[model samples]
Target: MVAETTLRPADLIAPLFVREGVTSPVPISSLPGVSQLDLASLRSEVAQLVSVGVRSVILFGIPLKKDPIGSGASDPDGIVQVAIRELRQCFGEEIVILADLCLDEYTDHGHCGVLTPTGEVHNDDTLVRYQEVALAQAAAGVDLVAPSGMMDGQVGA
Candidate 1:
Protein backbone atom coordinates (compact mmCIF):
# COMPACT_ATOMS: atom_id res chain seq x y z
CA MET A 1 0.00 0.00 0.00
CA VAL A 2 1.27 3.49 -0.78
CA ALA A 3 1.52 5.96 2.03
CA GLU A 4 -0.45 9.15 1.61
CA THR A 5 1.17 12.43 2.58
CA THR A 6 -0.67 15.42 3.99
CA LEU A 7 0.00 17.32 0.83
CA ARG A 8 -2.83 17.13 -1.66
CA PRO A 9 -4.22 19.03 -4.56
CA ALA A 10 -6.20 21.08 -2.07
CA ASP A 11 -2.91 22.26 -0.66
CA LEU A 12 -1.66 23.42 -4.01
CA ILE A 13 -1.64 27.13 -4.69
CA ALA A 14 -0.99 28.44 -8.16
CA PRO A 15 0.60 31.83 -8.51
CA LEU A 16 -0.82 34.03 -11.24
CA PHE A 17 0.02 37.40 -12.71
CA VAL A 18 -2.54 39.79 -14.12
CA ARG A 19 -1.26 42.57 -16.31
CA GLU A 20 -3.42 45.64 -16.78
CA GLY A 21 -4.57 47.19 -20.11
CA VAL A 22 -3.43 44.33 -22.26
CA THR A 23 -6.27 42.30 -23.73
CA SER A 24 -4.05 39.29 -24.33
CA PRO A 25 -1.38 37.35 -22.51
CA VAL A 26 2.07 38.93 -22.67
CA PRO A 27 5.26 36.93 -22.45
CA ILE A 28 7.42 37.44 -19.36
CA SER A 29 10.97 36.95 -20.57
CA SER A 30 12.53 37.06 -17.16
CA LEU A 31 10.40 34.12 -16.06
CA PRO A 32 10.53 31.50 -18.74
CA GLY A 33 7.26 29.69 -19.58
CA VAL A 34 5.28 32.37 -17.76
CA SER A 35 3.09 35.11 -19.16
CA GLN A 36 1.30 38.10 -17.71
CA LEU A 37 -2.30 37.32 -18.49
CA ASP A 38 -5.26 39.57 -19.05
CA LEU A 39 -8.66 38.97 -17.43
CA ALA A 40 -9.94 36.54 -20.03
CA SER A 41 -6.69 34.65 -20.22
CA LEU A 42 -6.48 34.56 -16.45
CA ARG A 43 -9.87 32.96 -16.29
CA SER A 44 -8.82 30.33 -18.75
CA GLU A 45 -5.66 29.68 -16.82
CA VAL A 46 -7.54 29.37 -13.56
CA ALA A 47 -9.91 26.92 -15.14
CA GLN A 48 -7.02 24.84 -16.31
CA LEU A 49 -5.36 24.94 -12.92
CA VAL A 50 -8.54 23.87 -11.19
CA SER A 51 -9.07 21.12 -13.70
CA VAL A 52 -5.62 19.78 -12.88
CA GLY A 53 -6.57 19.44 -9.17
CA VAL A 54 -5.18 22.80 -8.07
CA ARG A 55 -7.70 24.27 -5.70
CA SER A 56 -6.18 27.65 -4.96
CA VAL A 57 -4.37 30.51 -6.65
CA ILE A 58 -2.52 33.60 -5.52
CA LEU A 59 -2.80 36.71 -7.69
CA PHE A 60 -0.34 39.49 -8.46
CA GLY A 61 -1.62 42.37 -10.50
CA ILE A 62 0.43 44.59 -12.80
CA PRO A 63 -1.65 47.69 -13.11
CA LEU A 64 -1.86 49.60 -16.33
CA LYS A 65 -1.20 52.67 -14.25
CA LYS A 66 1.09 53.33 -11.33
CA ASP A 67 1.86 56.21 -8.98
CA PRO A 68 3.97 57.24 -6.03
CA ILE A 69 1.21 56.24 -3.62
CA GLY A 70 0.43 52.99 -5.48
CA SER A 71 -3.11 54.15 -5.93
CA GLY A 72 -3.80 51.25 -8.27
CA ALA A 73 -2.93 48.78 -5.52
CA SER A 74 -5.80 50.12 -3.44
CA ASP A 75 -8.25 50.90 -6.20
CA PRO A 76 -11.48 48.96 -5.87
CA ASP A 77 -11.64 48.57 -9.65
CA GLY A 78 -8.04 47.58 -10.13
CA ILE A 79 -6.88 44.48 -11.95
CA VAL A 80 -6.59 42.30 -8.87
CA GLN A 81 -10.02 43.27 -7.65
CA VAL A 82 -11.54 42.47 -11.00
CA ALA A 83 -9.69 39.15 -11.14
CA ILE A 84 -10.81 38.22 -7.64
CA ARG A 85 -14.43 38.92 -8.42
CA GLU A 86 -14.31 36.92 -11.62
CA LEU A 87 -12.63 33.96 -9.96
CA ARG A 88 -15.13 33.95 -7.15
CA GLN A 89 -18.02 34.08 -9.55
CA CYS A 90 -16.66 31.29 -11.69
CA PHE A 91 -15.53 28.96 -8.96
CA GLY A 92 -18.20 29.90 -6.41
CA GLU A 93 -15.96 29.28 -3.43
CA GLU A 94 -14.92 25.85 -4.63
CA ILE A 95 -11.53 27.30 -5.45
CA VAL A 96 -9.51 29.24 -2.94
CA ILE A 97 -8.47 32.67 -4.17
CA LEU A 98 -5.65 34.75 -2.76
CA ALA A 99 -4.29 38.21 -3.52
CA ASP A 100 -0.75 39.49 -3.21
CA LEU A 101 -0.75 42.42 -0.82
CA CYS A 102 2.21 44.62 -1.67
CA LEU A 103 3.22 47.93 -3.25
CA ASP A 104 6.09 46.93 -5.49
CA GLU A 105 3.89 45.82 -8.37
CA TYR A 106 1.85 49.00 -8.24
CA THR A 107 4.55 51.55 -7.43
CA ASP A 108 6.09 53.17 -10.45
CA HIS A 109 9.35 53.67 -8.58
CA GLY A 110 9.49 49.90 -7.98
CA HIS A 111 10.24 50.33 -4.30
CA CYS A 112 8.07 48.59 -1.73
CA GLY A 113 7.42 51.89 0.05
CA VAL A 114 7.01 55.57 -0.60
CA LEU A 115 10.25 57.46 -1.01
CA THR A 116 11.27 60.60 0.84
CA PRO A 117 12.98 63.65 -0.64
CA THR A 118 16.28 61.91 0.04
CA GLY A 119 15.12 58.98 -2.15
CA GLU A 120 14.95 56.69 0.87
CA VAL A 121 11.98 54.49 1.57
CA HIS A 122 9.51 55.92 4.05
CA ASN A 123 8.41 53.02 6.25
CA ASP A 124 5.50 54.58 8.12
CA ASP A 125 4.02 56.10 4.98
CA THR A 126 4.24 52.72 3.28
CA LEU A 127 2.38 51.01 6.12
CA VAL A 128 -0.65 53.13 5.35
CA ARG A 129 -0.62 51.94 1.75
CA TYR A 130 -0.27 48.32 2.88
CA GLN A 131 -3.27 48.67 5.12
CA GLU A 132 -5.26 50.19 2.31
CA VAL A 133 -4.26 47.35 0.01
CA ALA A 134 -5.33 44.73 2.56
CA LEU A 135 -8.75 46.28 2.91
CA ALA A 136 -9.12 46.57 -0.83
CA GLN A 137 -8.23 42.91 -1.38
CA ALA A 138 -10.65 41.84 1.33
CA ALA A 139 -13.40 43.89 -0.24
CA ALA A 140 -12.63 42.28 -3.57
CA GLY A 141 -13.47 38.82 -2.20
CA VAL A 142 -9.95 37.51 -1.86
CA ASP A 143 -9.85 34.55 0.53
CA LEU A 144 -6.27 35.31 1.54
CA VAL A 145 -3.83 38.23 1.33
CA ALA A 146 -0.09 37.64 1.39
CA PRO A 147 2.16 40.66 1.88
CA SER A 148 5.56 40.07 0.31
CA GLY A 149 7.23 43.46 0.71
CA MET A 150 9.01 42.51 3.98
CA MET A 151 7.95 45.84 5.43
CA ASP A 152 7.94 46.05 9.22
CA GLY A 153 4.65 45.20 10.89
CA GLN A 154 3.08 44.69 7.51
CA VAL A 155 0.91 41.90 8.85
CA GLY A 156 -0.07 43.98 11.86
CA ALA A 157 -0.65 47.09 9.82
Candidate 2:
Protein backbone atom coordinates (compact mmCIF):
# COMPACT_ATOMS: atom_id res chain seq x y z
CA MET A 1 0.00 0.00 0.00
CA VAL A 2 1.22 3.51 -0.75
CA ALA A 3 1.39 6.11 1.95
CA GLU A 4 -0.95 9.09 1.73
CA THR A 5 1.26 11.61 3.40
CA THR A 6 4.87 12.42 4.20
CA LEU A 7 6.72 13.68 7.23
CA ARG A 8 9.90 15.64 6.73
CA PRO A 9 12.77 16.32 9.09
CA ALA A 10 11.50 19.89 9.41
CA ASP A 11 8.25 18.54 10.82
CA LEU A 12 9.76 17.36 14.06
CA ILE A 13 11.67 18.85 16.98
CA ALA A 14 15.10 17.35 17.62
CA PRO A 15 15.89 16.94 21.28
CA LEU A 16 19.50 18.00 21.77
CA PHE A 17 21.70 17.86 24.84
CA VAL A 18 24.67 20.14 25.47
CA ARG A 19 27.00 19.32 28.31
CA GLU A 20 29.22 21.85 30.04
CA GLY A 21 32.88 21.13 30.83
CA VAL A 22 33.17 18.52 28.07
CA THR A 23 35.47 19.13 25.16
CA SER A 24 33.81 16.62 22.86
CA PRO A 25 30.62 14.73 22.26
CA VAL A 26 29.63 12.01 24.70
CA PRO A 27 27.19 9.41 23.49
CA ILE A 28 24.13 8.91 25.64
CA SER A 29 24.14 5.13 26.03
CA SER A 30 20.52 4.98 26.99
CA LEU A 31 19.47 6.88 23.89
CA PRO A 32 21.16 5.19 20.99
CA GLY A 33 22.73 7.47 18.37
CA VAL A 34 22.19 10.55 20.51
CA SER A 35 25.00 12.30 22.33
CA GLN A 36 25.65 14.99 24.89
CA LEU A 37 27.67 17.57 23.03
CA ASP A 38 29.98 20.35 24.06
CA LEU A 39 29.66 23.89 22.63
CA ALA A 40 31.75 23.35 19.52
CA SER A 41 30.24 19.98 18.79
CA LEU A 42 26.80 21.43 19.35
CA ARG A 43 27.33 23.98 16.58
CA SER A 44 28.49 21.26 14.20
CA GLU A 45 25.61 19.00 15.15
CA VAL A 46 23.05 21.75 14.56
CA ALA A 47 24.60 22.50 11.22
CA GLN A 48 24.14 18.90 10.20
CA LEU A 49 20.57 18.90 11.42
CA VAL A 50 19.85 22.10 9.51
CA SER A 51 21.36 20.66 6.36
CA VAL A 52 18.96 17.78 6.74
CA GLY A 53 15.95 20.11 7.00
CA VAL A 54 15.47 20.01 10.74
CA ARG A 55 13.96 23.34 11.72
CA SER A 56 13.38 22.92 15.42
CA VAL A 57 15.38 21.70 18.40
CA ILE A 58 14.76 21.54 22.12
CA LEU A 59 17.93 21.93 24.13
CA PHE A 60 18.77 20.40 27.49
CA GLY A 61 21.78 21.46 29.50
CA ILE A 62 24.15 19.49 31.69
CA PRO A 63 26.08 22.09 33.62
CA LEU A 64 29.49 21.51 35.16
CA LYS A 65 28.23 22.36 38.60
CA LYS A 66 24.90 21.55 40.21
CA ASP A 67 24.26 23.38 43.46
CA PRO A 68 21.41 23.45 45.94
CA ILE A 69 19.85 26.49 44.24
CA GLY A 70 20.47 25.29 40.68
CA SER A 71 22.11 28.62 39.97
CA GLY A 72 23.67 27.49 36.72
CA ALA A 73 20.28 26.99 35.17
CA SER A 74 19.59 30.72 35.40
CA ASP A 75 23.04 32.00 34.69
CA PRO A 76 23.18 34.23 31.61
CA ASP A 77 26.33 32.37 30.59
CA GLY A 78 24.99 28.92 31.37
CA ILE A 79 25.42 26.09 28.91
CA VAL A 80 21.91 26.36 27.54
CA GLN A 81 22.17 30.12 27.29
CA VAL A 82 25.46 29.91 25.47
CA ALA A 83 24.10 27.24 23.15
CA ILE A 84 21.09 29.38 22.40
CA ARG A 85 23.24 32.40 21.61
CA GLU A 86 25.58 30.40 19.42
CA LEU A 87 22.79 28.74 17.49
CA ARG A 88 20.96 31.99 16.94
CA GLN A 89 24.13 33.70 15.81
CA CYS A 90 25.22 30.96 13.43
CA PHE A 91 21.79 29.94 12.18
CA GLY A 92 20.32 33.45 12.12
CA GLU A 93 16.70 32.65 12.96
CA GLU A 94 16.70 29.63 10.68
CA ILE A 95 15.85 27.35 13.57
CA VAL A 96 13.35 27.30 16.38
CA ILE A 97 15.24 26.86 19.62
CA LEU A 98 13.52 25.64 22.75
CA ALA A 99 15.08 25.32 26.19
CA ASP A 100 14.11 22.58 28.60
CA LEU A 101 13.28 24.03 32.01
CA CYS A 102 13.82 20.98 34.13
CA LEU A 103 15.55 21.64 37.44
CA ASP A 104 16.81 18.12 37.99
CA GLU A 105 19.48 18.67 35.39
CA TYR A 106 20.72 21.63 37.44
CA THR A 107 20.13 20.32 40.96
CA ASP A 108 22.74 18.64 43.10
CA HIS A 109 20.22 16.40 44.80
CA GLY A 110 18.48 15.38 41.56
CA HIS A 111 15.13 16.74 42.67
CA CYS A 112 12.89 19.00 40.59
CA GLY A 113 12.51 21.70 43.24
CA VAL A 114 14.23 23.27 46.20
CA LEU A 115 14.52 21.06 49.24
CA THR A 116 13.29 22.18 52.64
CA PRO A 117 15.22 21.52 55.86
CA THR A 118 12.81 18.65 56.35
CA GLY A 119 13.68 17.34 52.87
CA GLU A 120 10.35 18.40 51.40
CA VAL A 121 9.99 20.21 48.10
CA HIS A 122 9.44 23.94 48.39
CA ASN A 123 7.11 24.83 45.51
CA ASP A 124 7.17 28.64 45.51
CA ASP A 125 10.91 28.91 45.79
CA THR A 126 11.23 26.57 42.87
CA LEU A 127 8.87 28.66 40.78
CA VAL A 128 11.12 31.70 41.24
CA ARG A 129 14.09 29.73 39.99
CA TYR A 130 12.15 28.49 37.01
CA GLN A 131 11.24 32.07 36.12
CA GLU A 132 14.85 33.12 36.29
CA VAL A 133 15.87 30.30 33.97
CA ALA A 134 13.12 31.16 31.50
CA LEU A 135 14.13 34.80 31.45
CA ALA A 136 17.74 33.91 30.96
CA GLN A 137 16.90 31.55 28.13
CA ALA A 138 14.71 34.18 26.55
CA ALA A 139 17.59 36.64 26.64
CA ALA A 140 19.66 34.00 24.90
CA GLY A 141 17.21 33.74 21.99
CA VAL A 142 15.22 30.67 22.93
CA ASP A 143 11.98 30.51 20.97
CA LEU A 144 10.18 28.57 23.67
CA VAL A 145 10.63 27.31 27.23
CA ALA A 146 9.44 23.94 28.42
CA PRO A 147 8.94 23.43 32.14
CA SER A 148 9.03 19.65 32.19
CA GLY A 149 10.25 18.89 35.69
CA MET A 150 6.78 18.19 37.14
CA MET A 151 6.83 21.10 39.55
CA ASP A 152 3.42 22.46 40.44
CA GLY A 153 2.57 25.81 38.78
CA GLN A 154 5.69 25.58 36.66
CA VAL A 155 3.69 25.61 33.47
CA GLY A 156 1.91 28.73 34.66
CA ALA A 157 5.12 30.72 34.80
Candidate 3:
Protein backbone atom coordinates (compact mmCIF):
# COMPACT_ATOMS: atom_id res chain seq x y z
CA MET A 1 0.00 0.00 0.00
CA VAL A 2 1.08 3.56 -0.56
CA ALA A 3 2.47 5.21 2.52
CA GLU A 4 1.10 8.42 3.99
CA THR A 5 4.51 9.99 3.39
CA THR A 6 3.74 9.85 -0.33
CA LEU A 7 1.26 12.70 0.18
CA ARG A 8 2.47 16.12 -0.92
CA PRO A 9 1.27 19.67 -1.21
CA ALA A 10 -0.48 18.80 -4.46
CA ASP A 11 -2.69 16.37 -2.59
CA LEU A 12 -4.15 18.98 -0.33
CA ILE A 13 -7.45 20.57 -1.40
CA ALA A 14 -8.80 23.47 0.59
CA PRO A 15 -12.50 24.26 0.58
CA LEU A 16 -13.62 27.85 0.25
CA PHE A 17 -17.03 29.45 0.51
CA VAL A 18 -17.79 32.55 -1.53
CA ARG A 19 -20.74 34.44 -0.19
CA GLU A 20 -22.47 37.19 -2.08
CA GLY A 21 -22.70 40.87 -1.15
CA VAL A 22 -20.61 40.92 1.97
CA THR A 23 -17.84 43.48 1.78
CA SER A 24 -16.13 42.12 4.86
CA PRO A 25 -15.56 38.51 5.76
CA VAL A 26 -18.24 36.99 7.91
CA PRO A 27 -17.00 34.35 10.31
CA ILE A 28 -18.85 31.07 10.48
CA SER A 29 -19.28 30.41 14.17
CA SER A 30 -19.21 26.67 13.65
CA LEU A 31 -16.02 26.80 11.67
CA PRO A 32 -13.29 29.03 13.06
CA GLY A 33 -11.23 31.12 10.63
CA VAL A 34 -13.60 29.89 7.91
CA SER A 35 -15.59 32.87 6.81
CA GLN A 36 -17.85 33.63 3.86
CA LEU A 37 -15.67 35.74 1.61
CA ASP A 38 -16.68 38.01 -1.22
CA LEU A 39 -15.06 37.81 -4.62
CA ALA A 40 -12.22 40.22 -3.86
CA SER A 41 -11.61 38.70 -0.48
CA LEU A 42 -11.73 35.23 -2.02
CA ARG A 43 -8.98 36.22 -4.42
CA SER A 44 -6.84 37.39 -1.53
CA GLU A 45 -7.59 34.19 0.32
CA VAL A 46 -6.57 32.08 -2.68
CA ALA A 47 -3.34 34.04 -2.90
CA GLN A 48 -2.68 33.39 0.74
CA LEU A 49 -3.40 29.69 0.30
CA VAL A 50 -0.99 29.50 -2.61
CA SER A 51 1.62 31.38 -0.65
CA VAL A 52 1.45 28.60 1.85
CA GLY A 53 1.74 24.98 0.69
CA VAL A 54 -1.70 24.40 -0.74
CA ARG A 55 -1.87 23.68 -4.48
CA SER A 56 -5.58 23.13 -4.89
CA VAL A 57 -8.93 24.47 -3.77
CA ILE A 58 -12.56 23.31 -3.82
CA LEU A 59 -15.21 26.01 -3.96
CA PHE A 60 -18.82 26.18 -2.77
CA GLY A 61 -20.85 29.25 -3.57
CA ILE A 62 -23.44 30.96 -1.39
CA PRO A 63 -25.50 32.82 -3.90
CA LEU A 64 -27.49 35.98 -3.22
CA LYS A 65 -30.59 34.34 -4.56
CA LYS A 66 -32.32 31.13 -3.49
CA ASP A 67 -35.21 29.36 -5.20
CA PRO A 68 -37.09 26.07 -5.02
CA ILE A 69 -35.16 24.71 -7.99
CA GLY A 70 -31.85 26.24 -6.91
CA SER A 71 -31.54 28.10 -10.16
CA GLY A 72 -28.57 30.16 -8.96
CA ALA A 73 -26.39 27.06 -8.74
CA SER A 74 -26.04 26.77 -12.48
CA ASP A 75 -26.02 30.46 -13.33
CA PRO A 76 -22.98 31.41 -15.39
CA ASP A 77 -22.71 34.58 -13.33
CA GLY A 78 -23.19 32.77 -10.03
CA ILE A 79 -20.76 33.16 -7.21
CA VAL A 80 -19.06 29.83 -7.85
CA GLN A 81 -18.55 30.62 -11.52
CA VAL A 82 -17.20 34.07 -10.68
CA ALA A 83 -14.91 32.62 -8.03
CA ILE A 84 -13.54 30.03 -10.44
CA ARG A 85 -12.79 32.69 -13.05
CA GLU A 86 -11.16 34.98 -10.51
CA LEU A 87 -9.02 32.23 -9.07
CA ARG A 88 -7.91 31.07 -12.50
CA GLN A 89 -7.01 34.63 -13.45
CA CYS A 90 -5.17 35.22 -10.18
CA PHE A 91 -3.39 31.88 -9.94
CA GLY A 92 -3.08 31.09 -13.63
CA GLU A 93 -3.64 27.35 -13.21
CA GLU A 94 -0.99 27.13 -10.51
CA ILE A 95 -3.71 25.73 -8.28
CA VAL A 96 -6.21 23.05 -9.21
CA ILE A 97 -9.70 24.44 -8.84
CA LEU A 98 -12.54 22.05 -7.98
CA ALA A 99 -16.20 22.93 -7.53
CA ASP A 100 -18.71 21.24 -5.23
CA LEU A 101 -21.52 19.98 -7.43
CA CYS A 102 -24.68 20.36 -5.38
CA LEU A 103 -27.68 22.62 -4.84
CA ASP A 104 -28.15 22.71 -1.08
CA GLU A 105 -26.62 26.13 -0.68
CA TYR A 106 -28.72 27.52 -3.50
CA THR A 107 -31.99 25.93 -2.35
CA ASP A 108 -34.21 27.80 0.06
CA HIS A 109 -35.48 24.59 1.69
CA GLY A 110 -31.97 23.37 2.53
CA HIS A 111 -32.63 19.98 0.91
CA CYS A 112 -30.31 18.44 -1.63
CA GLY A 113 -33.12 17.19 -3.90
CA VAL A 114 -36.18 18.80 -5.40
CA LEU A 115 -39.17 18.64 -3.10
CA THR A 116 -42.39 17.05 -4.24
CA PRO A 117 -45.78 18.64 -3.82
CA THR A 118 -46.05 16.68 -0.59
CA GLY A 119 -42.63 17.98 0.59
CA GLU A 120 -40.82 14.71 -0.06
CA VAL A 121 -37.46 14.54 -1.82
CA HIS A 122 -37.69 13.71 -5.51
CA ASN A 123 -34.62 11.86 -6.77
CA ASP A 124 -35.13 11.68 -10.54
CA ASP A 125 -36.09 15.31 -10.78
CA THR A 126 -33.03 16.21 -8.73
CA LEU A 127 -30.77 14.31 -11.10
CA VAL A 128 -31.81 16.62 -13.92
CA ARG A 129 -30.88 19.57 -11.77
CA TYR A 130 -27.58 17.96 -10.88
CA GLN A 131 -26.83 17.54 -14.55
CA GLU A 132 -27.40 21.21 -15.12
CA VAL A 133 -25.19 22.06 -12.16
CA ALA A 134 -22.48 19.78 -13.48
CA LEU A 135 -22.60 21.35 -16.89
CA ALA A 136 -22.44 24.79 -15.36
CA GLN A 137 -19.43 23.92 -13.24
CA ALA A 138 -17.71 22.44 -16.25
CA ALA A 139 -18.44 25.63 -18.17
CA ALA A 140 -16.95 27.57 -15.29
CA GLY A 141 -13.61 25.78 -15.86
CA VAL A 142 -13.63 23.70 -12.71
CA ASP A 143 -10.93 21.06 -12.82
CA LEU A 144 -13.05 18.61 -10.86
CA VAL A 145 -16.64 18.27 -9.72
CA ALA A 146 -17.69 16.81 -6.37
CA PRO A 147 -21.32 16.02 -5.75
CA SER A 148 -21.94 16.03 -2.01
CA GLY A 149 -25.65 15.41 -2.00
CA MET A 150 -25.40 11.65 -1.26
CA MET A 151 -28.17 10.96 -3.73
CA ASP A 152 -28.75 7.47 -5.10
CA GLY A 153 -27.01 6.56 -8.34
CA GLN A 154 -25.07 9.76 -8.00
CA VAL A 155 -21.86 8.23 -9.24
CA GLY A 156 -23.39 6.64 -12.31
CA ALA A 157 -26.01 9.29 -12.94
Top TM-score hit: 2
- TM agreement with the true structure for every prediction: 0.94, 0.95, 0.93
**Tens digit of per-residue lDDT, candidate 1, span 105-127:** 78889989888989888989999
Ranking by lDDT: 2, 1, 3
TM-score of the candidate numbered 2? 0.95
Question: Model 3, residue 72: what's the lDDT?
Answer: 91
| TM-score of decoy 3 | 0.93
Q: If both were scored by lDDT, which would come out higher, candidate 1 or candidate 3? A: 1
> Where does model 1 exceed 4 Å of error?
1-6
Give the TM-score comparing model 1 with the true structure, all chains together.
Answer: 0.94
Of candidate 1, the 10-residue stretch with the lowest lDDT total is 4-13
Task: Enumerate residue pairs that collide in model 2.
Answer: none
- Model 3, residue 64: C-alpha shift (Å): 1.2
Candidate 3 local lDDT, 22-108, one digit each (tens): 897889999997999998888888888888878899998899889998999989888998888888888887999999888899999
Off by over 4 Å in 3: 1-7
lDDT of 1: 0.91
